[model samples]
Every structure is written in structure tokens, then in C-alpha cells.
Target: MLKINDITNASSAGAFVVKKGFGAILAVTCLLGAACSSQSVEEGGLQPVALKEAATSASTQNVADKPNVLVLMFDDMRFDTFSYRGGPVPTPNIDALAAQSTRFDMAMTTTGLCSPSRAAFFTGRWGHRTGLDDNVALWHSRQTGLKDEEGGIIKRASDAGYYVGYVGKWHLGPNGMAKRGAEFVDTYKKELEEHERQGAPYGRMAQTKRYLAGERDENGEKNQYYLTLKGDYDDTQAAQKVRAGQEMIKSAAKEDRPFFGVISFSQPHPPYRVPEPYASMFPVDEIDEPANYMAKRVNKPLSQEIPWWPWHEVSHMTDNDWRESRAHYYGAIAMLDRAVGEIIQTAKDEGMWDDLHIVFIGDQGSMIGEHGLYDKSAYAYDELMRIPLLVRDPDVEPRVVNRIVSLMDVPVTMAEWMDLKPDGAVDGDSLTPLMLKGDSAITDAEDDALYAYEWYNGAWFGLRAIRTQDYKYVWNPGDERDELYDLKNDPGEIVNQIDNPDYKAKLLSLRKRLELRLVEVEDSSVTRLQRLIELNS
Candidate 1:
């Protein structure tokens, strides 16, 4: 464990240093105290038995004795968008939850796009296995020859005598639509058409119900957004979905079986539109652009092909346009925070808070103009790959972990908590060890690297990236362009150090590590990229 004094000393000597001011020294001391306290709790104070021994004993307990599960997923939300993380946006409700939960500083999604990453969560399988590696509309389960598989954590809970219900954002497939309550498909289709005619983006329940009914826009648009403009926050599509989740929780409480419900919200995504009160939550002048918001896509792979949009080119937008857009995005996030608070409060009201294990995470992160990208999928930047993951387990230590953990580990961890049989073939390991140990066996250097790929567009492209504490390396096989950044020296990832011969050995070693990981994971598609590199060689 690195001490706070050690961190302060290193920071003072490093390029990014915190000055030895009274405030800075005080902050450092406080941080060190917290870290030391957490370490002590994990060492022995939290449990009488050894951490490993306790985990084994807990796992032996049956599902009926296990804690109830509530998994909430937010859409297009970035890792640092909450006020708790010093983000400009205010999310008091989420911040409150963080105070009581264990927050992960490094949680990544396997894929940065919506559908593919979402499928990964539901199936507890990689995007390749789920056949949802891309976000193309034509790639529905039926069209892809995919079958409804019971592989999500929900299935494990259901098998453990828990009533499972999923609410909001069923991007995995249409399987959840009928479960959402719909008698006639045509009725939903008609409702959507009516909403479209009225120029109202599909309100929450209306849009989800319509999508489940297999409704499409007259123009043959693929996503639900096409049928209805981005809905407003109050009466918007996302809020309605959240309301449905609240109702489901209330209903589940009435049932005899302990319940596991997923509340997924779609917001802070494209069609950036929010309704009243929330829409005006943030003033225009207060919206601050990202530090690297103006970065150009020069000599970069994948990103060079993407066009510059308002998110990246906010400077080009008129004052009014920029304010309205930023306001809406922030408001949407506020709406999500409120919904989460309601859910948490509901659990308390229903007497389930103490006995329940809740997890909150985003499918993948979105870039709100960071590195000049808007929605994810084009690049593997931290803003797109890194997501927020919060876990609240009464049996585990409550502390923040800076170690890297992937979304792939969520299902296995949930299975362990629920005392259900785990599908052993998962690429991700259960994070229960970290939850109990307050540190990971894998060092920061070992856990720094992550893999992201996109098979969309005209070609199959792969980006192998390794993000160390002080540097980042991006290997693009298709373009044969490698990017390296000394993150310690340039936190903005502005300058590429790949051409610098001084770091040749380090780059080669990291590249080899990335390749080894691909092989270990049996990432066939990524391996294909390696083959292409070999063929070119």
C-alpha cells in the first residue's frame, strides 16, 4: 500500500505536483488518514475471520440467505460527470449514495458503444458471444440468429428463489418488452405514431412500450430516437422509464419472494433535450468546456474519420445553442440522480436497504467533448471506456478502490453475493476479493491496460490500449498508427510519444503485454488484427 506521504512526495517531484500549501498539506493528511483507516478495516477490523476465509463461508450460504440484488445502469454517462468527483455537474443524490457505498475509480466497459456494451452486462458474456458487438439497427437478435439465453446475473438470482424483474432500457433484445406489459403490439405501434405526429419525442413509458411493440418510424429509422425526438426530462422518455422502475420495486416488495430488479435509464445521450424545471437546472454561463475540448484529431487512428460535432466544436455553437445543450445534458443527469435517490429511499421505506446489495454502473461512458468526441465507439479514450461503478454490500468494507475493475466482473461478483452458481468461463474475475482486501493482487501497472474494438463502419478495426499510471499507448492495427502519451507529463493526452526513440523498449514491452492479454482472453477478432500486423511484417 502506498502511503499518502509517499504520494505527496512523488507528486512534488513529478511534473504534476501539488504545491506544499497549508490547504494542500491538510488535504493530503486527510486522504492519508482515510486510506489508513480503510486499510485497517480490511486487514482485520471488518470481519473476525480472515478475508479469504470469510468469503468462502459467505459463498457457502444458500441464495435464500444471500442478500437481495438491485442493479441500476445509466446510459451515456461519463465517469467524472458527478459532483462527487469534482465535476461541474451537480448530482447530490448520487453523491449521497457514494458516501454510503464503495466506489471504484477504474471501472471499464468491454465495448464503448451502447448496444454491444449493454448486451455484455445482461448476458455476462462478451459482445462476440452475444452477437451485439455493433450498434447497427439491422442487427437484431432474430436477424443475427441469436437465441434468448439465460446468462445474465438476473437468471442467477431467479434460480436462487428471487423474483427478478428488469425495468428500463432493454437494449439487449425484445425479450423484455412483453414483460413490460403490452397486450397488442399494434396498440403500441399506434401510440408511437400518434406521439410522433404530435411532435413529441416518445415520453418514457410510451417510447419503451412502443419499441417493444416493434414500432419503427415511417422513414425507416433504426433507433427509437428517430421515431420521437429526444424526450424532455420531466415528461421525457428516460424519466418515464425510471418511474416504471420505482413502480416495479413497490410491486416486488408486495411479493413473497426477495426480488432482483434492474433499473436502466437512457439519458445524457445525443438528442440532448430536457423538459422544464430540470432543463433550466444549470445556467448557461456556468457550463464549462472540457480542458481538452478543442483537441483536433490529427494523426490519430479511428478518430480522424469521425466528423467534428458540436460536442467537440462547442466554440462554433452560438452562445444560446451551447447554453441550451449543456443545460439539457446536465438536467438529464440531475433527473437520473433524482430517480436513483427515489429507488434508494424506496428500498429503505420497504425495509430492504440493509438486506440488499445494490450496484450502480453505466453500460459505457460517453465523451462530452473530451478529446473532441461526442458519443462513444470511434475511439478508446478514457472518457469513453471508463465508467462509474458503485457497490454497497454491508458485509464488505466501505472504501474507495483505485484498482482497475471491468464491467465484465459485475455478473460474477453478483453471483457470489447472491450465492448462485457462477458460469466459470467468464473473462472477468469476481471483485469480491478487492471489496474485502481494500487492494488488488494485480498492481496498478498490471491492471492499467484495457482492450476496446469496433467492427462497425466499413471495416473491422481494433485498438489495443495500455493506460499506465504515467503513460498511455494505443495500437491501431488497421491504420498502422500507434499513439503514445506520457500522461504524467501531458494529462490531456495531447502529444504522441510513439516517435520518441527514448521510450522504444517500454512501448515494445507494453505492446507485448497487450498481445498476451488478447491471446489469453481468446479475443479472436483482436487476434485477427495481430495476424494482419504479422502479415504486413
Candidate 2:
């Protein structure tokens, strides 16, 4: 393993320079993370991005300039787990929404961490530009806040004469840049404080439930993530957050305003606490192990330091323990779906469904025991990168898009549909064409590829990965081993084919593509150089 000191001391590693010490490095990393978060043009070039490149926003709304834009977002909900995707967990609410909207099979988060992903989504830029790359808030000092940025979306929307409201979790750094330009705001911080006062960990539940659920399984009493008989269904964090957002929707409707709001749910992320029957929704014995479970992953380079690494948890778990936890994770999602259904049904029943545009997506995804991993890490697997995206415009028909897309593209799409273009450049392409002309209509942003960064930590163990249709290339700087997976043959990414002679040409080609992409995105990391060297070696 690479020494921690070496990681901190390597001044030439591109993204970091210790200068004073690790403390100074952390401070600098956080500063750069928030500062470099938004850019007006493409990286390594000064040419202004043409908003016209997007398919002409042939708005379906009677009033093109004013439509009710609602973003129903979930936390840590991966792509495959949706019941419609053939996963064990059933999500009827999500599937019903997918049926009415254009479902994107390949949508990704630019950075697979909570704060940075949300920052990128709101700002429509990369984490590096926002200086919000790391999840650790202490690393970033958002002195001016996000709305202060020239590329600020909320302010731009507000300027366009739309009523904007922000509800639920806002991870845009400690300064609460998420509050910018909102007509009304109710943040999750107050709930966090309340939970602390009530002696409850807001995001987690006691582990005893998992143990009890497993014991029930062993005793042939069925299985569950937990079965709290007295737990209230409406008392979940998601339930409360959704209620807050519903109130905003009701108020927006009352005022007859074309409102833009983000209804984000903090569920299926952790604490594995499912209220009422959802905890016991999925039976334990029926929960099967992942196909890659116990496979030959010993040869794969794993992060040894993170306490929540899958191996760390798997080391102490039996098959039933794993199943119990897995069942509840899905149960939490099911509960979240109930909250979503309530939010949607309200719009339809109030006779405002015709004016509403709903965008459903997840902030990020978890590993879910894939590759012997329990949660997200520096790995570039699909389990953490891919997220489900559903776009429902009142003017358009339902279709499924096979082309690759990014959360970065969402703001641009929204801007065009609203007939408002900002003065600054954005890194995403609008999906308006796909939405208006169906899945066959092609835009500038095709099914090419997308870039992903797992920098929950700074450059200490950060990894940059490029995902294409057939393969994935992961560049881990310095002494860390680079990984290349042949997605066509090993979709699970179980095999490390980087050193195989048969794939040398493939590795070189992907390295060249990744290098050009990194340049296009202006990735200054030392791994920028290491990829070319490793390819040659």
C-alpha cells in the first residue's frame, strides 16, 4: 500500500501541494474544490459553448416560458435496484413514473460523492470548478456562497421570473449556498439538530435491528432489515422532507406561479431503518447473494484504510446478515417511493398535472455488496457511478433513451425549455431533442461516453474514471495501480485485464481517449501523466 505521508507530501501530483503540511493541503484542496467548481466554457479552451447545439426546445407547454419544474431526487439510489430493472427490490412508484417519462438507461453523476454531485447538479459544472470536490465541509470555506458564482443557476432562474423554492437536503457546502435566490427555503439542517436533540442519528438507525432481523431468519420466522412494531410510517426523514416539499408545491399552486423546486429525499442512503411493514417487505431467505460475491476479488486492488469498506463489513457478516441489511436497504427505498407517490398523486389530483414537469434522479448510488464492497469508495464501478433518470415534460410523449447522459446536462435542458439562456458557458448538452423528438432524435451529445470522479476524499486516494459503451479506464495516480475493465465481457468488472497481453492495444486506445478527455476537461491531476506512462510500460 502507498504510504499516507507519501500521498500528502507529493507536491507534484497535480491537484495538491502540501506546502505547509497536510493541514494546509486539506485547506487548499477544499478551497480549490469550491472555487474551481463552475466554469463558463469547456476546459483547456476559451471558446464559448453554443447553447444552440442542443435540440431546439420545442416546448410542449402552452406557455413555453413558464412551466412547473419539479426535481424529485433520491440519495444513494443506484440504477439496477429499481424493480423495473429486474432487481429484487420492488419500486412501483418509481416504475410508474418511468412509464410516463423518458427513462435514461445510462445517466451518471460527474462526481460520485454527495456534496460535489449536488453542487455540480445545481451549478451545471464540474466539482473542480466549484471547489466543492470533497464531502468534508471543513475543507471548503464558501465565503461568497454558491449563488455568488457567475454561473449560479438559482439566481439565473429567479432572474427569468420563475418562483424558486429549495427544500430537503442541501449539500452545497457549510455556508448553505443552496439557499440562494429561493423565494422560500427549509433546509435539512434543522431536522439534523432536532434528531440530535431527540437522541437519534438522522441518517442511521441502531445496528441492533439488523441483528434482530438476522436472528429471526435463523429461527425460521422469516427475515427483515428490521421490524419495529411501534415505528411510524410518516415519521421517516424522507417522509418529513417530502411533506415540506409538498407544502411548497401547494403554496406554489395557490399563487399560480411557475415554480422551480428540488424535492430531494435522504433515504436508502444509510441507517437501514425502514418504518412499519417496509422493514419486512422483502423476505430474508429469498434474498440471494450477488453473482460476484466471493468471487476472486483478492487480486483486485482494494482500499485498506476506509472503515466502511465492504470487506470490512463482510468479514464479520454471515450470508443472513448480509441479506438482512440488503433487504432493509431496499425497504428504505420502498418507503421513499411511497413518499414520492404521495408527492406525485397530489399534483395529478389538484388538476395541475398538465403544467407540471418532473425530473426524477438520484444524487448517487451505493455498492450494495457488489465486488465485495459494502458502500461507495474510490472505485469506478457502475454500482456507484450509474443513476436512474426520468424526465417527464407535459408537452412530450414517453420514450426510452439509450444514449449516455450526465447530471451536468440537466440544468442546460431546463434552461432551454424555460427559454432562458445564461451568459456563461456550461459543460452539459441539453436533452431537449430527445425529450421532444423521442429516442431516435440525435443531438450533439450522443451515446459517446461520460467522465466520473470519486473524490469523496481529496487527491489522497481520488480516482478519475472514464466510462464508454464497451470499456472503462480508471487512472489512479502515482503508486496506485490503474484498472481497465472490458465491460463487454466482464460487465461486473470482476477481472483486472490491465496486464493481460491480449488487451494491450485496447488499454492503449482507452488511455489515449482518456488523456484527450482529461485535457478537454482540464484535469490537472498527476494521473494525467501517469496514464500515458502506464500505457507505455
Candidate 3:
């Protein structure tokens, strides 16, 4: 096992230099791991990314520049977990929306963390560029909010003479959504605070503490991480936000201008709380273990550290506990689907459905016991990277787009569809062509790969990854070993093929691709950390 002899601060830049012994120990471990690996990995070369030209707007609306736009963002919802994707729980409302939309089967967030992904989505810039790469707790402590290097989508739409509104969770920062240029803003923080004031402090931690103290809800059940709402779902904070969004749509309908509203839900994130029927929706016994539930963390030192990692509560959980938690999570999604159905109906009833561009997406996905992990980490697995993205544009052909897309592409796409002016340089491509022409829109394979990163959880333990159709390469700058997964053979990402001689060429190609991508995005961390890692090595 590799050991950290000492970690010392290099300077005021917050960079820490690990003792040379740490890198030496890592080198010895890599050699041992290589000796034990015998499986052959695919040797795929990285080709130049060919981007398709933006096609004409697929606006069937008579007023192309003023079509109503409604964006629904979810928290911690995985693409594969929706009913349309054959997930464990049923999501009829979302499935129906997918049937009428262009579902991007391979949509990913630039960063797997919440605040960073939301920041990128709003600004159409990469997380690092926004300086909000970490979650709210860390960045909020530093008094950082969403950096508008480029204008956010709401501001862009509002500037385009559209009535915009923002409701529910805005994890980007404090204050209401006005900073993002929403005419109407409703925050979940105020609602949560009110619930706490009502002598019911609702949250995963608070409820778990109650459970640990042998406290039970009115239902006489000791729900550890979940709570059962006794009253109607409409009275709940999330459901009330749905109504607030509906009101926004109605108010927009009254205006002569086009409507642009964002209804973001905080459900299905944690605490796993839901109403009665949804709370007991999925039976725990019927919940099957994920195929990679017992996956080993051989060459991946980061995965090995996850079990004992700080702030992770799954270390003491058993299989049954995980299943129960998953069931609760599924139930939460089911409940959220109910609210989704309501908001969609509101838009339709307000006669904005025909001209509305509805976007149903998740901020980031959670790991539901995949690879023996719960919730997200710095790792770049599909569960954490992939999100549920389905866009319903009336003019766009309703079909399944298998091309890789990113959340950063969303606002850019919206801007184009709404005919909003460009604010600044955006780090994403418009998905207008994909929506208008589907797979045939891409004439080249240059945009076939997706670049993702995470650098917040641990100090300077950054991870940058390049994911193609058949493989994933993760560059853990300060870790004992980097990771390469043959996605074709091991879709679960169970085996780490980094040290395998068979994958040497492929690994080198991906490493170069990631380096070039970092340069393209002007990520200074890459240059700084890459130098540090090389010096230590």
C-alpha cells in the first residue's frame, strides 16, 4: 500500500506538495498491479474531433424568435433510472414527455458535482471558468456564487424580451434567482426554513439523527434516511414550487412576450423522503443489487479510499440498508414525476404547449450502490456523469439522439432557439443540428468524445477524464494510479485497465486528448497540476 509520508503547503496558491516518497510508493504499487493484470484491453486511437455545422433552427412555431421555453431541472436523477430507460421505478409523466421530445441518450454534465454543473449549465461555460468548481458548502463559505463570465440563460432570455421565472433549488448561490435575471423567483431555502420553524426540521441528516435516537414518524416506522409526509403532496415544498412555476407560466401567458421559466426540483437528491404511496412504492426485497455492487477497487486508488472517505455515510451500511435507501430514492423520483406532470399540464392548459420548448434534465446523477458507492465522488463513472436529458421542442423532430451532449450545451441551444444574442465565448456546441437532423447531422467523429472533471472533494486531488464511445480514461493527478476502462467489455467500469500493456496506446491517445481539451478550455489547473505530478513522479 502506498503511504503519504508528509503533505506540506507549497505556497499561498493552495497547492500541496506530497513527499517524494509518496510518488515512489505509487510507482512500486503500479508495477505490482501491472504484474497481476492479464486481461487485454482495446487499443483505440483518438481521432480528430469533427464538429457538425449548425443547421437551420427547427422552429415550427410561427414566431420562431419568441417561442415559450420551459426548463425542468432535477437533482441527482440518473438517465438510466427513469422509466423510459427501464429504471427500477416507474416515471410515466417523464416517459410521456420523452415520447414527445428528442431524448439525448448520452447527455453528460461537465462536472458531476451539483453547483459546478449548475454553474456551467447557466453560464454555458466550464465549471473551472466560473470559479465555482466545488459544491455550495465550500464555495459558499468563500462567498462565491455563479460567475457570469458569460450571461446566464435566464438573463439572455429576459434580454430577448421574454418573461423569465426561476423556481425551486438554485444551488449556484444564495439570494433569490433575480441575480440570474428571473422576473419571478422562488427559493427552496425559504420553504425549508419555514418547515424547520414549524417544529419539523426535515432533512436527511436531521431525520437520520432522529432514527438513530429510536424516534419514529407518525406512521410508527423508524425510517433512517427517509420521511413520510402525512398531508397531501401539494402542500409539500417541492409541490408548492411546482405551483409557483405554474403561476409563472400563467403570468407569462398574460404577457405579450414569450415565456422562459425554470422549475428545478430538489427531490430525489437525499433524505429520500416522499409521501405515503411513493414512500412504499418500491419494495425493498424486489430491489436487485447492481451488477457492479461488489466491484473491486484494484488499480483505482480513489475507489479504494471511498470506503473510508470523509463525509460518506455508506461505509457502515449493509446490502439491505442500501436496498432500502435505493427504494426510497426511487420513490422520491416517482413523487417528483407527479409534480412534473402537474407543471407540464399547466403549460398545456395555458395554451403555451405548442410553442413551448420543454427541457427535462437533471443537475447531476447519483451513484445508487454502483461500484459499492453511494452518491457522487471525484470518480468519473457513468452513474455520476450521465444525466436524464429530454428536450421537447415543437419544431424539432421527436427522436432519440445517441450523440454525446453536455449540460453546457443546453443554454446555448436555448439561446439559439429563442434567438437570444450571444453574451461571450461559450464552451459548448449548440444541439440545434442534432435536434433538427438527428444522427445524420454529425458528419464527423470529432465531437464523439466528452470531457468531464472533478477537483473539489479532496484538496488538489483533481480528476480529469476523456470518455469516448468505447472507453474512458481518468487522469488522477495526485493519486497512486490513473484509470482506463474498456466500456465495450466492461460497461459497469468494474475493471481498471490503466496499467495493462494492451491498452498503452489507447491510454496515451486519451491522455493527449484530455491535455488538448484542457488547453482548449484554458484550464490552468491542468498545466499547474500536470507539472506538479510529473515533478513528483
Candidate 4:
């Protein structure tokens, strides 16, 4: 495992530079350009300066010369799915990208739900702060999107003279993506509207109702409800989204403005509908169970008492059934990998690869038989929180970030790269310092810890977590099932150390850290934790 101490100063590295009478500036010197020297502002000011030179070069460049941003998102993808992570799946495309990118192995989302995670990714804020702390159901149509004054990443890029486009999953509301500042918007709203117009069942809820009503396809398969149509791989929702992204990129190439396109894939989420060879690619018999598969849920939160969904409950699944489901899930990832290769190849063909800042990430992960859980619920386990985050900036060298980072940091990092102003104060920090300077770059205490929360999962049993590299502490407000895990000793999180006398000090320290973060984010759940802290004090 890579640690902060393992990272050495490269020929091209970033450093913090402070000028007299002026505020401290974290400058990334000797990037894609020539090698330059960098000095720490703490060590006192140095003579060498390259930021001004880089800024001058940038000011003279045209819009076409500016770097384009391409954000590709996956749904419900685990961190260890790709070959880069030594998982079962062979994602050659993603593997190649990871080899040339900064892989955040410890990347986590603010929430494990799709809507809330994506909302944080866009707004650079926590889910509860944005009023999108859960999935958007029919009653959540009023959850709309970020206000114009609330400058989101998309709006910031648009304001910075980049032609922005968004295609595929935007779960903030019914038509959130369409109302964004995107010049080209292609989401599921139109498809659902057309389905409703034709008097056909639309949306996941309707599909779930139809499946529960004993509706089966010609193949007599009851689990084919997730796909609106199942024929060719090209006709699948994932492929359609990729094609839309390609078209958007191609169209943006014709314009004089730089492009910022987001292509979100809904595949590998559930139902695992991969057509043709992909479906048979991963043999079910060869599939193996996860390390923590069917592990006793002792000392875990009570929220794991039930499965996430009715149709895919773990209780109804046998050993072979679990293997088959896992195989299908791998097949879905392989299928999505092919689609990813296509979109990236399209960008390269259009000459956008040279200057494109690419970001590939999963909105959040799901429990694939981890601790006997099928899907994501109100749990802050490693399986549900750990996501794949690969960032390939043309200017920054490729490396691995071993520390924990949040999905909300995506927008803040991009804003720093593009020099765009966000709406207001954000909970996330720019990752440039970490990417360019490594462990020494983390000057703030907040950067050393990652926080996650889940408010709804059929109940209001709030779960707030604070995790560092060595340990993880989960606070179950108003519940007695709070958890503490020594990650260094038990990475699988099977042994909860909350009750261990040896870990009492560690638990108290983590609880205080979590309380501070909750107060910082203005989360109401912090009240109960605060009272508990007072009692302990």
C-alpha cells in the first residue's frame, strides 16, 4: 500500500509559494511544461517563480488551446472491479486509463445513494446541505437543481467560456440535467416522457410494480425489468449514453469554445443486463465469493437487518444464485468498459485527448454480498462507500493518492484547475496540492479525514462516519449499534472495536472529529452526538 512517506519529490512537482504582503498561493510548477524549481512558503520565500510564466502563457492562448474537461461516471461500481485493482473483471480500457491517471484508491462518496452523491459531485457541497440527501422519488420532483447564483461546476465552466454538455443520469430531480447550463442536454427525461405519452410503464418504480405483478419477458426472465429494451449492446442504455457523449464531443469540436462534457453510465447498477458475448464472458462457476461474504453482521448497525430491495434480497439467493449474480455484474462492468473505450477513443480522434482533463468515477458503490448484504442500505461499510476515482490531467503527472477523498472534491478540483469561482463556501478541497505535492501538501486537518452520511433507507436511522487511513468510526445517532474499525488491522471491517477497552481512546478521538465535521457542515444529526460527547466529557 502507498503511503504519504513513500512519495518522493519528482523532477516536476508542486509546492506552496507565499509572497510578502500578499496571501499564500499554492502553485503547481513544472507541470506539462519545462521542469521548474518549487519552494515551500513555510521554508521562506524563494527567488524562483513559474506561476507568472505559466499564467502569461495561458493568457496568450486561445479558447481552443485551453484544456477540455470530460467527466465519465459509472453507477454502483465497486472500487476493486477493474484489473488495476486486481479484481475479477478485465476492464482493459479503464485499466489503461488508470495506468496513466492518478488513482484515488480510498475515494468515497458523501452518501451511498445515487442522487445525493451526484448532487455533491456537481455542487461541491454535502448532500444534506443541498437538500438532496436521498434518491429522488416521485415526491422529490421539487428537488430541482443548484440555483444560478449557487454556481455549480457546470455553471462555473459555462461562465468560464467553456461549452458544457451533460448526457445520461442526473438524479437530482425529474429534469435537473436539462435545466443546467449545459449547451447540449440528453437525459432520461425525454425517454420517460415519451414512454408516458405512449401509455407505457416508465421509471424504476413502475417497472418494479410491473415485475411484482408477474410480468415476464419472452425469455421468461423476471429480472429483465431494469432495461427498457434488451436486444443489442448498442441499443442498451449505457451504449446510448456513450453515443450521445461521442456526438456531444464531436459537435463541441466544431465550435470555437473549449468543451466540458459529462457522460454518466447507468449500467452495472442492477439487473446486470449484458447482451451477447459479455453475458457469457464471466463464467459463474469460476466466480468466487467476497472475503466478507455472508460474514456475521454482529456489532453492525440495525439498519442492515433488511435487504435494500425486495426483488434482489440475499435471503432468497442460494450459493449458485449469488455466483450467477456476481458473474452478471462482472459482465455488466466489461460491457461498460467497452463503451468507455469507445467514448475515449472518440475524444482522441477529435484531437481533444492532448488537452483534455479526464475524470472517471463511480457515483457510489454497492454491497455485493459483503456482510450478506445485496444492495446499498443505510450502511457506511467499505463496500458501499469505496468508489473508483481516476483523474488524468494533461498537466499533472500520473500517481496514486493513498489518502481518503470525497466525491464532493470533484467540482472543487475542477474549479481550481479552470480558475472559476464557485457559488459559496464548499466542504470539499482542491486536490491539486495532493496530486502535485503528495502527503506534504495536506496542510489542513480536514484533509486527513473523510466523512460520509446516510439519512434515509426506509427509516431515519442516520449514519455518520469519519474515516482516516488507519481507522474508521461510524456514529449511529439515537441507536446503540455505533461501529469502530481498526482499518490497519482488519481491512475487511469484520471486527468492530467499538466495545474494546483498548480502543476507547481512539473511539473518543474519532467521535470528537466527527462531531466537529458535522458542526462544520451544519448537519442537524450532530445534536445527539454533541450531547453524547458532553456526557462523556
**TM-score top scorer:** 4
Alpha carbon lDDT of residue 128, candidate 4?
65
TM for every model, in the order presented, reads: 0.74, 0.77, 0.80, 0.80
Cα lDDT, all candidates: 0.53, 0.56, 0.61, 0.62
Candidate 2, which ten residues in sequence have the lowest lDDT sum? Answer: 19-28
lDDT of 4: 0.62
Candidate 1 clashes: the total is 2
Candidate 1 residue-wise lDDT, 1-537, digit = tens: 101111121111111100000000000000000000111100111100000000011122244444567777776677887898887777887898777677887887777766566666655676555655654232111222123453555555555666565544444333332332211111011111111111111233343454456554344331212112232333444444444556656666665555566655545554354445665678768777766774776667755554322123223334344445556667667767776776677777766776567677877766655564545555667777788888777766678888878887777777666666664356677777788786665676567646566554223556666666666777776676788888777777777777788887777667766777677667675666566446533
State in Å the error of residue 529, model 2.
Answer: 3.6
Candidate 3 lDDT over 1-537, as tens digits, reads 111111121110111000000000000000000000001000001011111111122233434346677777777777787789988778798798889888889887777766677777777887666676665433112323565444577777666666666655665554425654566655433211111111111244454455455565555543433456554464454565565667767776676556677766655664455666776788889988778885766667664464222224455456766777778777777777777778778777877776667777887777767877766667789988888788777766799988788777787887777787777668888888899889778764555445455555334456788887788888776687888999999999999998899887787777776767788778876785456445533
- Candidates ranked by lDDT, best first? 4, 3, 2, 1
Better of 1 and 3 by TM-score: 3
Candidate 4 is scored at a TM of 0.80
Collision count for each candidate, in order: 2, 17, 2, 0
In model 4, which regions exceed 4 Å deviation?
Answer: 1-65, 138-151, 190-230, 443-449
Q: What pairs collide in candidate 1?
A: 204-237, 233-275
Candidate 2, position 432, lDDT = 81
Q: Give stretches of model 2 more than 4 Å off.
A: 1-64, 138-151, 175-178, 190-230, 304-313, 437-446, 530-537
